[model samples]
Target: MTKTILITGASSGIGKETARLFQAKGWNVIATMRNPDSESELSTLENVWVTKLDVLDLDSITKAVNDGIQKFGGIDVLLNNAGYGAYGPLESFSRDKILRQFNTNVIGLLDVTKAVLPHFRQNKKGLIINISSIGGKITFPLGALYHGTKFAVEGISESLHYEVEQFGGQVKIVEPGMIATEFSGRSFDFSNDDSMVEYQKIVGALMGAMPAMAQNASPSSVVAEVIFEAATDGKNQLRYTAGEDAKMLIANRQQYDDATFIGGIKAQFGL
Candidate 1:
């Protein structure tokens, strides 16, 4: 069978790159995003179907899955890659902003996974690949909301594997460090209240460190390749770290205790 992969947030970044990679490798791709009408590139691909899927909207998620299955005969893999980074001091966040962060990143992922469970269960074999981040294992200043959601993703994927594995289904997590993508642009949300003078210093520190981080960022293609590996390696691996920085950070995290690891982050940000 020519296997099909359904990807979320495929309009740009790693999602778009992965869709292209899979299609080039002869796999059918259902490249979904919030606005499909604006996508011109993926829509032109032969085996790729560009569709609409907003993680915050359950109806859109379900419809995207069903429509992809119908178009490609059955989805063999589900790539939960639709999420953004929400940064800033926790105190600066509004109730709605907090909810939106959680809804789009954590809750939305669960909902999409739930919608696809039946299909995977019936097939008795499937792959669920989630795009977590290095932030999931290590925190940075002004990243409470983003890190919280990614940490939730890590836990969910790890625990969900236990349940799904019994029926030949597998769940995997891809932790990418910092890919050169538009993530810092349209996909990033930073909230801050300047009136809260206490947070200004840390905000300035974070802003200053960002440019250096961008300079070290690997291309989105790097993460896309990691996702491809997880999809096809057919190994029982639970997690795959993408990018050189991701590997180094994950290793350091494993080698350090809470205090040491946190101190290193503080030093990096000059906090």
Candidate 2:
């Protein structure tokens, strides 16, 4: 029987590309997003079902999972790829924005994972691929809240792996660095305050350097391919880096002490 994979945030970027790649490989694709009606591409593909699934909405999460299973017989993989970055100075972040970042990136991911757990537990075989970031393992300026959410994901996935292993379920994290996607554009949130002139200057400098940082970034499709490997590799691999930059940076981080690693990041951004 052909396997099925359910992906969140399938309207664009890595999720969208992964849905296409899996469909191309003969897997049933449940390509979910917040506004399924607005999606024109994935909805038209064969073996691909575009459905509404807002990770923050528990009802939608359960509905999407059920809908996928109902249509495809069973879901073999769950790709938790719905998330966004909240950038800018921590002081400039309002209470709502900070909460929103955590709610969407961390809490929402957990909810979707919870919704799929029963099915996985019953099947005794399943894979969960979380679209974490290089930020999960390291930090950068203007990304305190975003990094916090990713770090939470890393820790949560690590702990959950042990619990699920008893039943043959697996968890894998994909860490992509500066992928060329709307994630750095429309999907990104930037906070600022006119009253905070010093912060404005600092944020401006950081934002200015972002384009250069992303110039050598890999495309979203590259990350999609990595996710595909993580899902099908059938190994006990817990973490996979998606880009050369991610691999290099993460390797450097592992080799260096905390102070040295942090200093390298500061030097990279001219901090």
Best by lDDT: 1
Computed on alpha carbons, the lDDT of every model, listed in order, comes to 0.92, 0.91
Candidate 2 Cα errors over 4 Å, as ranges: none
Give one digit per residue, the lDDT tens place, for model 2 in 1-271.
9999999999999899999999999999999999999999898999999999998899999999997899999999999999999888889888998999999999999999999999999999899989899999998888899999999999999999998899999999999988786445667898888798877766776877888887878999999999999988888899999999899889998999999999887777777
TM agreement with the true structure for every prediction? 0.98, 0.97
Q: Using alpha carbons, what is the TM-score of model 1?
A: 0.98
Give candidate 2's total backbone clashes: 0
What digit string (tens of lDDT, one per residue) describes model 1 on residues 26-92?
9999999999999999999999999999988889989999988888889999999999999999999
Candidate 1: Cα lDDT at 154: 98
Badly placed stretches (over 4 Å) of model 1 are none
